[model samples]
Target: MPAGDSWLFEMKYDGYRAQAAIAGDQVRLYSRGGHDWTRQFGFVAPALATITKGTALIDGEICAIDQHGRSNFSLLKTSLDGRSPIVFFAFDLLEQNGEDVARLPQAERKARLEALLTDLPADSPVIYSQHVAGNGQQVFDAMKAGGFEGVIAKAPAARYYGGDRSTAWLKIKAVQRQEFVVIGWRPPEYGVDNVRGLFLATYEDGQLVFRGAVGTGFTDKMRREVHEVLQLILADGPLDVKGMPRAEARACRWVEPRLLAEVEYTEVTPDGLIRHPSFKGLREDKPARDVHLEVQDA
Candidate 1:
């Protein structure tokens, strides 16, 4: 995490990034990829509508909270099938009273967002994402100890760069996690499910490169569900990827690089492969082209 008084640290949620636009009684929700998901997240829209009587734009995450009140991505995937309730953790206010406030400093935006959510009921679906001006190390340690995802360190005086990745915001994870494009797959050796492992890839130097494979962290039901989706997007041949082994290439089934997979790994090898990687879930919030190995910037 960044060490300085000018930095603000907030809890990094393990959930889908979403934006809510409120215009009077009309509240529309959009995904990170700019897809309309108001219906998919019907449970959270009503709470957003109650935020302002005029108009406002809020940016936050839609997450499924576990029994311990921590955001859980696995639970979120299950909840997508209409199994459980979800919450919207509002973190920033982009537009207030129909006026664009994105150019405002990060600290100012967060303060306005908190104020907008202050009148929400105790059991409201939308909650403000609180942050600390400093003490990043202390917060990260506490989050790690509590089995939370991680912390996001942001420059308090920096403006919001919407739809653009910037150094003003940094993600510091307790565990290593990344989003990889699903390039290929391997059939289960001896199982009812069609998929056993996913061959992953990430963008490097403006080209797609073979990262590695992830076979673990899938439940029997999830395996079956994911296999169904993979079947429809089969490709005639693999996309030309740098460092693909010929032997493994002949053994795998290639697919269109439209699916994004969330993966957790212990570390990266010297040759640019992920170690001890496991599948977490499929991510639809982000475009596959944006999947790249994250690095800390100075």
Candidate 2:
């Protein structure tokens, strides 16, 4: 994170990036890729609709918060089964009252967003994503101690550039984590109908490249569910990945790289492999082709 009073730091959330479009009595929730997911996260609409009677557009994250008030990505899937509650943490106000606010500065947008959600009931699912101005190191230290994901430093004067990555926003992760495309898998040696590990890869310079396998961090149920999906999408030939070890290439049961998995790792090896990797869960909001090696800003 850059050290400056002009930078606004917000807690990086571990959840799906979503937008809420509220028009009169109608509220639609869209994914990061603009796919409508209102029905999937139905509980969000009522709380957001209560925010205004006119039209508004809000950018935020849909997260499953644990008992410690931490956003837990693993609980997101189980929440869909009605096991836990999910909420929307609105961070930016794109449009409000039929007025375009995308070009506004970060500070202005956040102020407007907070004001919009301030009147909501205490039990409301719509939340205002709070941020602290400056103190990059202090904020990072506090968040890391609290077991938070990371911090997003935003240029206070920067305007929101929808659908584009901007230099104005920088992310500093307390833990190294990102999404990877599942290229294939290794079947369990001793068990029937179980996967031993997942073969992962990411896009580099327009080509898919091998990243090594993640052998741990799977529950018995996850192994079963993932195995069922892998069976259906088996590829006729191996993926045209670069730098795959010969032994792994021979052992892999290649599959279409359409499945995306979120994984955490200790660090990236000099040879371009993730070390001490742990699987978090599968992510559907992002496409597999968009998965790439994320390098944090220094």
Candidate 3:
């Protein structure tokens, strides 16, 4: 695939990517990883019922936006009392009026989505994802200038390829630092009893990518915290990847990838790995997978 192509660009929202399917009065919300989040986000289902009649599959991010239009995931997680305003930034229409429209070109689907929301209330949970024609680079630049993570470029005429990581959808994220769980440890090539470095991995797009390991920036307290977590998951056995054991020694304790730390990095490698990443701190609000290497716009 080439670098830059004719594509529909949207802001890479900092929230869970969900597909909301409304059938008659029944609405089912599925996360990007295929998890049923219908119960967790009940507020959205009721709003979806009001706008959709027969059936509609809407692609969007379930985000909690503040007064300044900035997403607040931490606030969203804590204030689950059903009072916080959660908005669904509807970006695409997959199925409408009992017809499967995902096979149609993306431009057609987006047009349908836009027409559906044209007369709706602006403050409604559903908001049409904005796009500018013939200015992909400018859109990307504006997103970066606004301190956003990045942008995602989707082929305007592409079809919905479910459960498949295709280059048709390209994600460009802001270069930010984040820490990950030290799931396992790898030995040094030649050294004493000390291990070479810790293996860092995070879940993204339903898969785990080894974000390289961290040998430096380890404090005594950090090491102790990592060791304690590693000890617990070790008895269960080494963490499996693709049905095979991760490339780590038995002596190395395998920890559950639950811990969230902050790290800083400059760029992502050609293989979609983080480069020159350094530890920052623990982030209690974010999940391990959400901390994976940032996606870049192709």
Candidate 4:
């Protein structure tokens, strides 16, 4: 098929991005960053071995679905405690049989992928990632209502542009929400400045962006707990701002943004600033840098 400008869009799954390579009877799973996670997902190796033809390269997410039909990352992480079955939602077929399909138009590749999955067991871990024909906005809205992370839009005929954040593939995230390590605090001016607001920071593109501080949405009890946590990490020095911290009328006291807290915000401004963010709660699982902004779409 001749490649065109038409693109095929798919749901931006909210799990780990993985590439499954099936050659003969052997299967190897590689993370997007090129790490081998096959041993971590040992339960999926056999499922992948079912591919009977030549080498096949599949790109998708390794997610665990709960009884409620929702993707649960926390469950996956806990269950695996380093060993669990992982369902691979295959979204794209980069190679099949003995042919390399990465250079083919997306529509053709998708058709081939659909045909390949049609005869698989109904409840197989390997399933297709369905796409909307032309209603991108509808899919986007549906994802939001369902609490999904986001949607990716791809040119129907665009070839695979590996490791490139090309405009050809666009991502539209539902909302920017993550748990960040509260390395420091900025006190509100008025009454008891036990800990007015929190300093938020996450790593992105290898650079740290202080996503501004959040003071709203804190209960008195939550404030006390946060104050205790910040007290231990307290250091006597001005907060480090590779870039100047944007301050509002709210008087502030700076601390090391070292503790982790869950936060939800509307979006990231063009200059990498977060807008209208509010504190959610404390998160103990994730590290500081791992809390960075993620582009949900392509």
Estimate, for each residue in 1-298, the C-alpha lDDT of model 1 and write its tens digit.
6887779999989989999999977999998889998988877878788777899988999999888989988788778776666899998889988678999999999888888889999999898998988888999899999999888888999889865368888888899987899998888777566688899998776788998899999888888888999988999886888887887687788999989999999988888899999889998898787778876332
Can you write out model 3's per-residue Cα lDDT over 31-105, one digit (the tens) per residue? 765678888887778777777667888988887776667665544654467656787888889889878889998
Give the alpha carbon lDDT tens digit for every residue of 1-298 in model 2.
Answer: 6977878899999999899999977999998767899999988898888888889999999999888999999999898876777999999999988788999998999998888889998889888988998899899999999999999888999889864247888879999998899999998888689788999999887899988799889999999898998998999998899989989989999999888888999999898999999989888887677778888863
Candidate 3: segments with Cα more than 4 A from true spot = 1-6, 82-84, 176-199, 202-209, 213-235, 240-252, 256-264, 268-295
| Full ranking by TM-score | 1, 2, 3, 4
What are the TM-scores, per candidate, against the unseen true structure?
0.95, 0.95, 0.69, 0.66
Displacement of residue 100 (Cα, Å) in model 4 is: 3.0
Residue 132 of candidate 3: its Cα lDDT? 54
Q: Of the candidates numbered 2 and 3, which has the greater TM-score value?
A: 2
Comparison by lDDT, 1 against 2, better one: 2
Runs in model 4 lying further than 4 Å from the true structure: 1-7, 81-85, 177-207, 212-241, 244-264, 269-271, 275-298
- By TM-score, how accurate is candidate 2? 0.95
**Measured by TM-score, how close is model 4 to the native structure?**
0.66
lDDT (0-100) at residue 112 of candidate 3? 92
For model 2, the superposed segments whose C-alpha errors exceed 4 Å read none
> Residue 48 CA error for candidate 3 (Å)?
0.8
What local distance difference test score does each model get? 0.86, 0.89, 0.67, 0.69
